[model samples]
Target: MKSKLSFLLLSLLFYHYANAQTAPGFKELLDSAMVRDADLKAQQTRNKLTVLDQHKLKDVYLPTLEVSGMASYLNATARVISPELNLQPFLNIPEGKYNNNINVSGFSGLAKADAKMLLYSGGKVRQLNKALEEKRQSENILLEKTSDEVAAVISRAYDQLALVHQSKKVLDEAKRRLDANRKTADKALGYGLITPYDHKKIELAQATLDSKMAEYEGKKELLLTQLEVLTGIDKERLRLIEPVLVPVALPAPQKTIDQRAEIRALDHGINASGFKIKAEQTWWIPKVQLMAASYYIGLYGARVKSSDNIIPPIPAIGYPGRKLDWKPTNLNIFPMLTAGVGFKWEIFDGREGKHAIETARIDRELLQNQKYDAMRKLTLNQANNQSNYNIANSQIALKKKEKEMANNALVQAEKEFRYGMSKSTQLIEAENDLEAAELDYQNAIFNQRRAAVEVMRSTQELDITKLY
Candidate 1:
C-alpha cells in the first residue's frame, strides 16, 4: 500500500510537470519575447550610445592638452657689402678682392605643448550640455516606447495562439459529434430505417468537419511558428494558455497622452531643440579661455662659413684667400612658457549662426506640431480602444449565452435523431451552430484581452514587470 501510494503521488507530480511545461502563461511569453526581440535590443544599444554622448559632453569644459614635435634641416646664405673704401694701407687688403659672403646650415628641432580651458562661453557650453542631456532623455523614452511596442506585439501573438488553441478544441468536439452521427446513421441504414442517401449525408458532414479541423491545425501551426520566432521558444514545446480577459478603465485622454512614451519623447526633443537654439544664439558672445603653452627649440650639427677678399694680390708672391670656417656645434635654447587669457567673438559668419538658430527653432516647432498631432490621434485611439473593450465585453456575454443554447440544441437534436424523430440535416446544422458559437465566444474573449493591452500601451502602463 505504501508503494502504491508513492507511485500515485509520483504520477500526479509528473502530470503537473508536463502540464506546466506545455502551457506557458501570457506573462511568461511576454518576458521571453522582451528578451529575444531584436528591435528592443537595437533600441537599447541606441540608448547606450546617447549615454556615451552625454559623457562626451561632460568633458567639453575640461582643459585640453596637446603636445607636438617637429624636426627639419635648415640652410641659409647671405652676402654683406660695405661702402667702397681704400683699405690697402690700413689693413693691407686689396679692394677688388673684398667679399662678404656668409652661409649657415643646421638641423633644427622644436617641441611644443599647450593647454586650454574654457573660462566663459556666454552660456553656450551650458546650453549644449543641457541639450545633450535632453537628447539622452529622449533616447531613454524611445527605449521605453520600443519596449512597449514589443510587449504589445507579443501580447497579440499570444492571444492569437490562445484563440487557435480554443478553436481547435471546438473543431475537435465537432468532429467527434459528426463521427458519432455517422455511426448512428450506419446502424440505421443496416436496419433499413434510414436511406443510403441519409447515410452519405452523414459521411459528408464528417468529411466537412475533417476539412475544418485540418484548416485549424494549419492555422495553429502558423501561429506557433510566429510565436517561436518572436519569443525564441520552440514551437513544439509551446502550448499557450488563455490570457485573462479584463477590460481596463480608460483615463482622461489628455492625461493618458501626456503619459505616453511617444509624447514624452517629443517633449524632450522640443526641449533639446530649444536648448540648441539658445546655444546657437550665443555664437555672437565672446568666449573666454585660459591658455598656456610651452615651446622648446634646439639646433644640432650647425656650421658657419665666412669668406672675405681683403688680401692684396702680388704677381711675384703666392697669396691665399681670407676664409673662416666654424665647426659644427649643438645649440639649445631654454624652454619658452607663456600663459594668458583670450577671448574669441565671431563678428560675422555670413549669417551661419542666424541660419542655425532658425533651423533649431524650426525643429522645435516641428516637434511641437508633432506633439499636438499625437495628442489628437492618441485621444481618438484611446476612445476607440475603450469602446472596443466595452463591445467585446458585451459580446462575450452574448456569445456565452448563445453557445449554451447551441450546445443544448445539439443535445436535443442528437437525441431526436437517435430516436428517428429528427433528420440528419438538422443534427449537422446543430453541430455547426455549436462550433460557431464556441468560436465566437472565444474570439470575443481574445478581442477583449487585446483591447485591454492596447489601452495599457496607450497609457504607458504596459510594463512587463507589472503585468507579470
Candidate 2:
C-alpha cells in the first residue's frame, strides 16, 4: 500500500511539470509573432523589390535584339514626251515610231532583324549599378529594424498579461483568507463573543475581491485579443507563462548605439545618394553602342506597259496591248547586312541633369544630418532606460520586504481575533495590506522587465536568444 501511494504521488508531480513545460512562454510567442506579423512581412516584400531593381540594372549593359516584318501593295503609271525618231538612225526604224510613254505596277514585302550592344555609357551604368547595390543593403537593414520593432511590441504585451495573471493570484489568496476568517467569526457569534456586524463586514470584503477579479479578467481578454492579431494565433491556444526575471547587463552606451540597425540603414542611404549624384553628373557624356542589322526583301506580280510601235509587231511575241508579265518570285534580296557604331549625347536638356545632381546632393546631406540627430537621441534614450531599470530593481527589493512584513502582520491578526483579543476589522486590514504588497512587488518586477526590453531594443540586441 505504501509503494502504491508513493508511485501515485510521483506520477501526479510529473504530470504537473509536463503541463508547465508545454505552456508557451515569452520566447515562443515572440518567435511566432516574427513569422506572422504583417508589418514585418511587408518590409520583407520591399526588400525583394530592391533585389529585382538590382537585376534590372545588371541587364542594362547587355545587348538587345528586335525582329519585324511588313507587307504592302504598290501600283503606278507614268507618261513621258521626247524627240519622236530616237532609234531611226541606229536601227533604221521609221520616224515617229518611237514615243515616250511609261506605265508600271507591283506588289512587294520586307522582313528585318536588328541587334545593338552597348559598349560605353560614360561610366553612368557603373554608377547606377553601385547605387542600386547600396539601396539593396539599406533595405536589408530596414528588415532587421522591422523585426526588432515587432519583438519589442510582443514583449510589452507579454509583460502586461503576466501582470494580470499575478494580480489574479493575489486576489484569490485574499479571498481564501477572508473565507477562513468568516468561519471563525461564525463560531465566535454562536458563543455570543462577536457582533453580527463584524460578520457582515467579512461578506462585504468578499464582494470587493470578486469585483477586482472581474476587472483583471476583462484586461486579460483584451490582451489576448491583441496577441491574436499580432501573432495570428487563436486566443484559446495562447497559454501564457510567467516570465522569469534575470539581471540585465549591457555594453558601453556609445558602442551599443553605433551598432543599431537604424544607424546602419542611414549610412547606406547616404552612400546610395552619393552614387546617384555621380550618375547624374555624368549625364553630359555620350553613350556609345555597336549596331548591326539584316534585311530580306522580295517583289512579286510585276507587269509593264509601253507604246506598241516601240516593239515591232513580231509574231513570236504572243502578248497583246504591249504588256509584259514578270514571275511572282522573280525579285528578291536575300540578305542586306549593315553594321556600325553609334552614340547619343544630350548637349542641352533645360538643365534637367543639373537639377537631378543637386537633388541627390541634398538627399545625401539630409541623411547625414538625420544620422547625427539619431545618434544623439539614441544616446539619451539608452541612458534613461538604464536608469529606469536600476530604479525598478530597487523597488523590487523594497516591495519584497514589505510583502513579508504584511504577511507576518496578517498571521498575528488572525491569532488575536481567534483569541477574542482583537476586532474583525483589524484582521481585514492586515489582509488588504498583504494583498497590496504582493501586487506592488509583481508590478515592480514587470516594470523592470519592461525597462530591460527598452534597453535591449536601443542596442538592437532584442532577439529571442538574448532576451531569454
Candidate 3:
C-alpha cells in the first residue's frame, strides 16, 4: 500500500510538472521585465517631460520677430512727400504745409517689420534656469526611487519562492517518515502485536501528511503567480535561482538621513523654490531689448472714379486757361527700413509686483518647512525598517533553536515507538510538534527576508539600475 500510494503521489507530481510553467531567475526576469514595467516606463516619461520643460525655458530669453501690413483709403489724409512736411523748416509753410499736406481724398499703405531680443530681464532667465535644473534633479531622484521599489519587490518575491521550496522539502521528508511508520504499524497489527486503534492512528497521521503536501503544492502555485506579477515576466520566462540566505547586517545607528533619496528630493525642492523666489523678484526690474528690422511696402488701392458726380459749369472768368486734364494716381511699392532699442521700467504696479515677490518668498519658506517635514518622516521610516529587520533576524534565530529542540524530541519519540515503549498517539504528537516547529522556523526566515528587503528599500540601495 505504501508503494502504491507513493506511485500515485509521484504520478500526480509528474502530471503537475508536465503542465507547470518554467521561469527565469529574479535578475534575469527583472532584466526582461524592466522593459515592460509600467512604473519604470512612467518614470522615463517624466524624465522626458522634464527635458522638454528645460528646453522651453530658452524661449523666454530669445528674440521675437513679427511682420504685418496695413492698407486703407480715406476720405481725407496727408501726402507723404509734401516738401513742407519733409522736416525742412523753411518748407513747412502751408499747402505742402507741415512737411506734408492734407488731401480731401487719398490713401496710404504700410508694411512693417519688428524684432525684439531681450538684452536683460533682471536675472529672471538665470533664476528660471536654476529652478529647472533643480526640477530635473528631483525627477532623477524619483527615478531612483522607482527602481529601488522594483528591486525590493523582486527580492520579496524571491524570498517567498525560497521559503516555499524549503518548506516543501521538509514536508516531503515528513511525509516519507509517516508513510514508513504506518507500514510498521500495519505489520504489527496483523501480527496481533498492536491494536487496530494504533494502526488507525498511524493511518490518520499519514492522511495529515497528505493534506500538508497538498497545501504546499497549492502554496507553491500561488507563490509562482505572485513572483510573475512582481517581475513582469511572462509565465514562461521567470525562474528562481536558488536564493541566497545571507544574513543582513544591521545599519549603524549613526547613519544620517542626508543620503536618502527622499531627503535629496526635498533639498532639491528647497533649491527650486529659492530660484522661484528670485524669478518673481526679477519682475520688479527694468527690461531692455535690442531690435532691428527691414521690410518692403506694397500699396494697392482703387477709388472708383465717380465722374458722374461732377457737375459741369460755365464759370469762365476766373481760370479760362485752367481747363487742364486731370491726372490719375497709381499704387506704388517701396522699401521700409527701421532700427531701434527699447527699455521698459516697471516703476510700479500698485504693489502687484511687490506682492508677487512676497508671495514667492513665502513659497520658498513653505518649501523649506516641507523639506524639514520630509526629513523627519524619512528618518522615522528608515529607523523603523531597520528595527523591524533586526527584530526579524532575532526571531529567525530563536525559531531555528526551537525547531532544533523539537526535532530532537521527535527523534527520541520515533525511536521509542520503534520498540514497544511508546504510545502511538504520543509519538504522532511529537512528530506533529516537530513539523509545526519547522513551519514556524520557515515563517520566521521568510519574515526576516521581507524585513531585509524593506531595509534595502528604505536605504535606496537595492540594485535597480537593471530596471532602466
Candidate 4:
C-alpha cells in the first residue's frame, strides 16, 4: 500500500528541547521551544533591541568621557640658543645649543581628556525609548503567537493518532467475525446446507471487512507518524500514553477575546504603531550629546652622549649630527582629557518627516481596526467550532445507545438463523446493521474527541507546560 505517512515525514525542521523531564508528566518540549524554536529565537533576539534601547537611555543620563594618547617618532629642526641672537651683554660667549624641538628622531606625546553632557532634547529621547519598548513587546507577542500555534498543531496530531488507534480494535474484531463467518459459509456449502451464492455473499462481506481493516491500519500508521514528529519521538518506539481526557468544564470566559495569542500580538503591534507615530512626530526635536577624550604624549629630543657628551647631530655644515632618543614616556601622553557638549538642531526638510508621521498614524489606525476585525473573526470561528463539538458529543451519545441496541438485535438474529427460524438475507441484514452501528459509534467517538482537542486549542489550554 502507498504510505499515507509521507507528509508527516516531509516536514524538515526541528527545535531543540532539553531531555529533562518536567513535574507530573510534562515534557521539556515547551520549555525547549522557548529557546530553540526558530521563530521564538528570532523574536527573543528582537526583544534584546529594547534592552539596548534602555541602555541607550542610561547613556543619555550619564556624561560621556573619553581618554586618548599617542606616541610616535617626530623629527624637527634643531634649536640654537646663541648669545648674539639673544643680545645679552653679560654673556658674550655662545650659550649651550639644545634643540627643545624634536630632532631627526624624537618622541612626540600628548594626553587629553574630554566630557560631554546632553543639555536638552525636545522629548525625542523619550519617544524613541517608548518606540523601542513597543518593538520589544511586539517580539514577545510574536513568540506567544508562535507558541500557541505549535500547541494547536500538537493537539491536532495527538487527537488524530488517538482516533486512529481507537478504531483499530473495532476493525480487528469485525475482521475476526468476518473470518469466522467465511469459514462457516465454506463448510455449510460442502455439507449442502448453504448454496454457492450464499458462500459468495459471505466472501463479499469478508472482503469488505478486510478492506475496512486495511484502511484503519493505514490511517493508524499515518496518524502515528504525524504524532511522532510533533512530539519529537522516534516513530518505532513512540508510544502515546493514554490521553487525559478533560472532563467538560464550564469555561469562565472573559467578556473580551484577549486570551488568544493572536489578539495579544495584534495589541502589541498597535502599540508599536503608535510609538512609531510618536517617533516620527519627534523628528523635529534637536539631538544633544556629550563628547569626551583623554590622551598621553611624551617628548623625545636630543640624546645624551655616554662618552664625550659630544652629540653627533649639528647643522653647522652639510651634516645635522646626533639626535636624541627619548623614553617611551617622552613620546606618549600619560593622560589627556577634553570635554564638550554637542547639539544638532533640525532646520527644514521637504516635509518628509511630517509625511512619515502621518503615515505612521495611518498605520496605527489601520492596525487597530485590523485587530478588532481579527478578534471578531476568531471569535466566530471558536464559537462555531465549539458548537460543532457539542453537536458531535451529542451524536456520540446517541450512537453509543444505537450500537448497544444493534448488538442485542444481532445476537438475537444470529440465534434465530441457527435454528432455521430466520432467512439468510435477514441474518445478513442484521449483521450489516450491527456493523453500521459500530462504525457510526466509533466515528462519532473520534469526532467528539477530535473536536474536544480543537476546543482545548481554542481555549489556549494545550500548553505542554500544564500537560503531564
> Top model by TM-score, which number?
1
Query: TM-score of every model?
Result: 0.83, 0.82, 0.78, 0.66
What RMSD, rounded to one decimal, does every model reach? 6.0, 7.0, 9.8, 11.4
Model 2 C-alpha lDDT per residue in residues 252-330, reported as the tens digit of each score? 5444788888899899899999999999999899999999999998777866655444444434345332333334544
Clash count in backbone of candidate 4: 50
- Local distance difference test, per candidate? 0.81, 0.81, 0.71, 0.63
lDDT of 2 at 177: 85
Q: In what order do the candidates fall by TM-score, top score first?
A: 1, 2, 3, 4
Per-residue accuracy of model 1 over 1-468 as CA lDDT, tens digit each: 999999999999999778657867666677888898888888888778778877887787899999999999988988866523455675555555555777778999999999999889889888988998898888888888887788788877766776777787788788777878888888888988778887888888888877887888898788888988888776756744554433334444344668988899898899999999999999899989999999998889998776664333444456454465776578887679999999998999899999999999999999999999999999999888778878878888899999999999999999999989878888888888998899888888888777767767777777444333
Q: Which stretches of candidate 4 lie over 4 Å from their true place?
A: 1-119, 240-255, 293-338, 347-352, 420-429, 453-468
lDDT score of residue 6 within candidate 3: 100
Candidate number with greatest lDDT: 2
Better of 1 and 4 by TM-score: 1
In candidate 3, what are the lDDT values of residues 1-468, reduced to their tens digit?
999999999999997675454446556756655666788898899789878878888776788889887877656444444332132343232343323333344466777778879898888888988998998998888777777767676666667767778777788888878877887777677777778888789888888888878987787778777767766555554443455444455444333667778778878878988898888887768888898887764334434222221222223434222211233465555565677888888887788887887887887788788878877887788889888988998898898899999899988988888775777898899888888898888888778767766666665655433221
Ranking by lDDT: 2, 1, 3, 4
Q: Assess candidate 1 and give its lDDT.
A: 0.81
Clashes of each: 3, 0, 11, 50
